[model samples]
Target chain A: MAEIVLEGITKRYPDGALAVQDFNLTIADGEFVILVGPSGCGKSTTLNMIAGLEDITEGTLRIDGQVVNDRAPKDRDIAMVFQSYALYPHMNVRDNMGFALRLAKADKAVINAKVEEAARILDLTQHLDRKPANLSGGQRQRVAMGRAIVRDPKAFLMDEPLSNLDAKLRVQMRTQIAALQRRLGTTTVYVTHDQVEAMTLGDRVVVMRGGVVQQVGTPQELYDEPVNLFVAGFIGSPGMNFLAATLEQGSLRTSLGDLPLEDRVRRRLEGRDVPRDLIVGIRPEDFEDAALVDERHTGHTCSATVDVRESVGSDVYVHFTEEGGPAGTAELAELAADSGRADTGMQGHRIVARLSPATRAAEGSPLDLWLDASRIHVFDPATGINLTHPER
Target chain B: MMSHRNRTLTGWGVVNVLVVLYALFPVWWIVALSFKDPSTLSDGNFVPRKWTWENYHGIFQTSEFTRALINSIGIAVIATTIAVVLGTMAAYAVARLRFPGKRLLIGMSLLIAMFPPISLVSPLFNIERVLGIFDTWVGLIIPYMTFSLPLAIYTLSAFFREIPWDLEKAAKVDGATPWQAFRLVIAPLAAPGVFTTGILVFIFCWNDFLFAISLTSTTAARTVPAAIAFFTGSSQFQQPTGSIAAAAVVITVPIVIFVLLFQRRIVAGLTAGAVKG
Candidate 1:
């Protein structure tokens, strides 16, 4: 295992476009770090720099405490699994797995033993002689994994390796890859655009946007405590709901209703010139069916016609529209664009609430939703900074 | 309605048979003429009046025909080898690399491919004479290779482009140097395309007549097509039709055999399914 450190790693194209800038991270040994973002955010470029596939523009990259910016990929001793699998079409599974050893001039018996062991681990022992063309998509993916496994390199770099599979196979391979990584205990730097993959696979998720690291934390840390509007919206499914709010006195007024500022937030805002316009963030799970809420707790309540209702066996999600005016900010706009939710002239902001499955919610009917106001987030409208974030 | 479809099928069948005959009749007639008896050489019928081995024997007895056959095989093989090797390198660059003048290089090759070979005969004839290489095998081989290089590059480059570029990256990550990556991975995948290109280049050189006739003056380096033109009968007044036809049939044997032997690979190369959708 190897620990990789990127100190101010930057990638500047010859045409003067900066693809990645000031990228700094220290991956501990055996840590699974995921770099995730939408397309063209330079997540792949950053991974390539670590693998020595792309040249670092103006920073140092160190693997196991040695600077390796000029080292060739083969010399870096890292194995990479590509999005396309990239298996040799002309070679059978056995040969493809043993190719690296053959190149290194390993003994024939050693190569065969290693390849056979990798094949068995991947459950590909029965198809050692089959070419990539004859194998199913999942089988080809496994061969790619087997090829990487046989190398036993210092580290592993994966660039969306499960992207090309169908949804069912993708889920299956996701767990397999995680299990394999844990068993091998290899430090891996994985790049993916899928947030779910980032959440499930990474020991620590590095959320990137516009070629910048917005936050770096464990999946649960990022989910429960996003630092800004972008990370707040990007990490969870049915992403965090945003509403424009106005702060007056010690209370915040939003379209959902007025919520009393918690003592911590009131203290943070005390003796300061607070911004009048704010954006309130609430996650789907923070909302509950009004009837299901405990009588001991005071919950902020709102009423709206349910635009749609989905019963997913475990819970029901109610999608409704509100006149919150889309929480206009640069970060929210970028997040909306990344999620393909921008520029359809959506009349108003859409908010999703996860409630108890027993709730008698139906489409075109008004529903009472009780939100945990104490858990609500307040952000400065201009800067997208979370005003109520404890760490900030 | 079924009868109407049957009539259409019959009409297409007749057309196809006629087309096949139209293409193969000349080759059959040449083979038939090679076996015609000397007495019936002037029969001028579709079917030979008499069959004999006299014409084949007559051509085989001449050292000039045998020498020309050797010249044709040697020159075509050498030219094809050189052209394909150079073409594969150039094609790989054209398919994969981005350089300042790549488009210009492609355009220049296209220009040479379309230029009339006959137009260069006179200048090449003079140049080779000045170089003291005229009527030499080197002279014939040079022009053959030069003209065929463009064809080889175009065909091979198209094949190279179809290869998934990710395989190279995968090889590098698997601990292969650039040279090893090529020898162990890319070269094997490119073999079919290279073999197909070699056959095409050899055929072009083998069938060339304009360059062969203009550049050579005697049997010293004359290829098969040129050698056939120089065949003469026993007497100055007699026609050499039978001998010429026999030589023509003899020269065609190698090409037919090559096509038969590599027909499957040629088809696969042309329609290679290197990458799945």
Candidate 2:
């Protein structure tokens, strides 16, 4: 029920390592904002600063319009759910959920009532008397959530709380968490490295990289018009495909074939001191099997030998290697390294297209594919900045 | 013919029996001697040739033995309580804080733990005399605390480090002050380690003879181990073997009871932090 504002928040360690730099955000009241990035990208550090677990090197954190930079965590009235769950091992579920109220010396009956209500909300009423050790991973996670919920705090800070659960339980809890947050309407700041969680859970996602804020927008906005190559590559599951291209006569000559720029894209590229060598970003779903594409809607088409074809019920993903090299840029290289795919040693550019399952694309067979030219994003290879979506 | 597994099991059973006998024979002999009549004290029989309760009755009848029993219990209990409380705080600091000379502090405590207590007994005796606590409970308790604090710290710090640091952070965010977080959350979790260390400290203080006999000149602080040496028989030429055995049995009872009461906790405390659950 509170709005949290971070004004130029920065975290500098004693060894002079900057963990987070000038992080700025103003989460609206009751908004669920996610800080998403790869490991060591300072998302968790920023969250700790917000929670008052880490010292803020230079910034003012304001909660509900009051500056709380010097306040302790308890004084700030925010509850945190740690990645490890951090349930009091010695206390049973009832006591764990009632800890905060008991610490505040609340009436026994009130503590019991609130704890029972929270347990019921988390579907943990049956486990009220059990210790955290006896509970399954998902149940322990629910208790951690229940611990936060029973307090009725001003805000909630979750640091990869679901990361320890199995995949199925994680999704189940993620949905539960979303429903619970909507019902409670508490300001929540969740930090996670999983982009899908950020995309699904947050009203607005703040993407960070190397201790700096990359972009802050809605998930759809980031997916449709990413501020840079990193956000574009980090947002999607299969990730956006980047193909190296050379600008020639207002047409981009890529390995997929020469694609004529649409009028709107050409206008964006005009008079901008654009680079000749560019990177074209295309979402996987933007490409379709040419045989399935309607003839009435013409677009850029190319043929490539499919290296792998994976069908996942709804769509068939076909991966092909282009003759041109990877979209080589410092940003793309760092992204590849972050994803643990840099040392893969596969030559040429690998592109993945999500086509209809009805398509007959097969491994090692040449398949014609149609690209939605208007959906493609043109980037300056030297800067990793999207040329078409220059305005964030 | 025995199967291989059966033979191995038999071999282990024999070894275990031997270990049990080797460990308990002396204790049984002491009990047997305590019950033997004064005249049958040195008979070759393992069990007493004739048993009587006179030795136990004799030891309890003396004010000197009773006073020493009270002194032993009081000094060990006080020393254990103080050492465990101080050690828990120091160990928590060592495990969690980042002050300078942390490594030096740990190393120095370890050096003290390994130092020979006999070497310091004389120096400590002189120091205690000068300080006017030479023959008092305070004198005996000080040395015991000094010797046992390091052990307490080492054992408790291992347990403290095994506790997740996130719990403290969670407690803080749960509306607990630093002190409240420790008392309500951390201390309860460290109960096993504290109990284990307390029993060990108590046992060390209870059985100590070198410092106890050397420092105290009278019954003021003469613990049972030291008092047993000064026991006398009814006659001038008689040896007080039964009385000494009775006192030894009396002092050993507390330690045995302590171990038996907390045997499971001691084992758990020793191996608890070795792996994450």
Candidate 3:
């Protein structure tokens, strides 16, 4: 219903804790925008600020080019679905859905018509007479959705609304919500902690951390070209493995062996002050199963022992420890849990490689890996910024 | 197979029944006395010498017990009305709004409740004398509120907290002002709590004896508790047995009916509103 723009939006509590700082994002009308981060990352705080639930510490929030920072939440023409549902327990589905219209003093026929239409949309027609206590978790969540839909507000704000449901229901509702948003074509701002939800739901996802926007782009942009190590690791599942080694004698070498970098990437890595702690990042799928003793392969490779291997029918996961590959200081904070990972390989200097079900390997066995050089992410070990080779 | 724990449980159950019997004995006596013949009111046996309706007749037909019961109802109704409105408004503010010195205000309300109210009777009498409203329904209603408001405000405030903030925000987004949200969303969700609070205030206001006795010198403001105490004169030491018994029955029956009607929600509301599971 409206395009929303957040210009230098920030939230600073009275105690001087900045929940969000200098946040800027542009969400087009009829687009689904997701704010995502770990707990205490201020993703939800930012969403609340946009909904008029929290005061903006600085900057302006505009919907349809109208500054709405000082406006009350109701005047902003938004509807929200809460994580807990928060349905009125005393009212039946009909009353719950129609409550806003009734308060607006809409005619009885208009309220009834709107409630019925929303119920039909949500498959809740038969539950019109039932109170929230009588409904199942998924049903109650739908009722919360119905309350918002009936209002036909300018924007829909959802704060992890599916988080409380069981895993299966969460998935089902996630799809339903995305589909509903598409059908309604309302400008929506959603805050979720789950990256998968963010990737799947967002037209433009804003990845936030430490009360700051890390990157704002389409999911494809983030997955393909993350601006920093944090975004690269946080946006992908079984994240990109970050390894440390050094550039020596115009080539990259680790205790494992010397690895060939693309001429273009090599030129970038060998630039001024050659990186002492060069971090090599490769996707799990990018690490192809190979034999260290293979006779033919010569171009691209990294080495780690096969610590543990798991199979999930469709694909096999080989988690291995990097012997002399890159391990020391190349990892991001989330990846730091894998430091010194040599024992169980569950959390340590380990790399998880996705293999075909046909490949087989046992735990604790040393194995060789071939990297798809085109997909490898090379970064400055200290700055964590990607060493992008425009030619490559 | 019975274990040692089962034997202990059975022993505890027996003791619990005995405790319950001790609690019910006085109530059972009052009901029995109300049905006994007026001539046998002083009889010794727990069972009346003859069960007759004559004593009930004496109270219902002769005395002003009915008038006194109506007067008590009127005063309790007025007191509960004033207390519920003020207490709920103040509690909502305390629970949801952030005003300066709110915690201190809440502390003062609790302090008012903690002091024994008997100390305030004379001061209240003086205030009433100055206001020229003593011995009236207004005087009785005023005194009862002091006992009811604190509990109502505290209970209602706790109830307000359990209503998830999302609901209010949703109401706000739906084009309702903050006041409208409180009236529509909060008031409905908190209705059960309000009922529970009302029942508590009603019971306290109805049973208060001191203020009802000292403040009102006439039948116009004398409540059931005060009226019951007047059944005997100091010099004669003679109790109006039938009238007092009949009045007790009238007073307790409504309470029992109320409990029966709202037993489930009231229990749930109390536990939910009080931070209990």
**Top candidate, metric TM-score:** 2
Off by over 4 Å in 2: A295-298, A343-348, A390-392, B268-277
Ranking by DockQ: 1, 2, 3
Total backbone collisions for each predicted model: 0, 0, 5
Model 3 lDDT tens row, B179-232: 888887788778778888888888898888888899988787788888888775
lDDT of 2: 0.90
Q: Please name the candidate that would achieve the greatest lDDT relative to the true structure.
A: 2
In order of TM-score, best first, we have 2, 1, 3
Which 10 residues in a row give candidate 1 chain A its minimum summed lDDT? A264-273
Worst 10 residues of 3 chain A by lDDT: A335-344
Q: Positional deviation of B16 in candidate 1, in angstroms? A: 1.8
Cα error, candidate 1, residue A156 (Å): 0.9
What TM-score against the true fold does each predicted structure earn?
0.96, 0.97, 0.90
Inter-residue clash pairs, candidate 1: none
Q: Is the docking of candidate 3 incorrect, acceptable, medium or high quality?
A: acceptable
Candidate 2 C-alpha error for residue B38, in Å:
1.5
Assign candidate 2 its CAPRI class: medium
What value does the lDDT take at residue A135 in candidate 2? 85
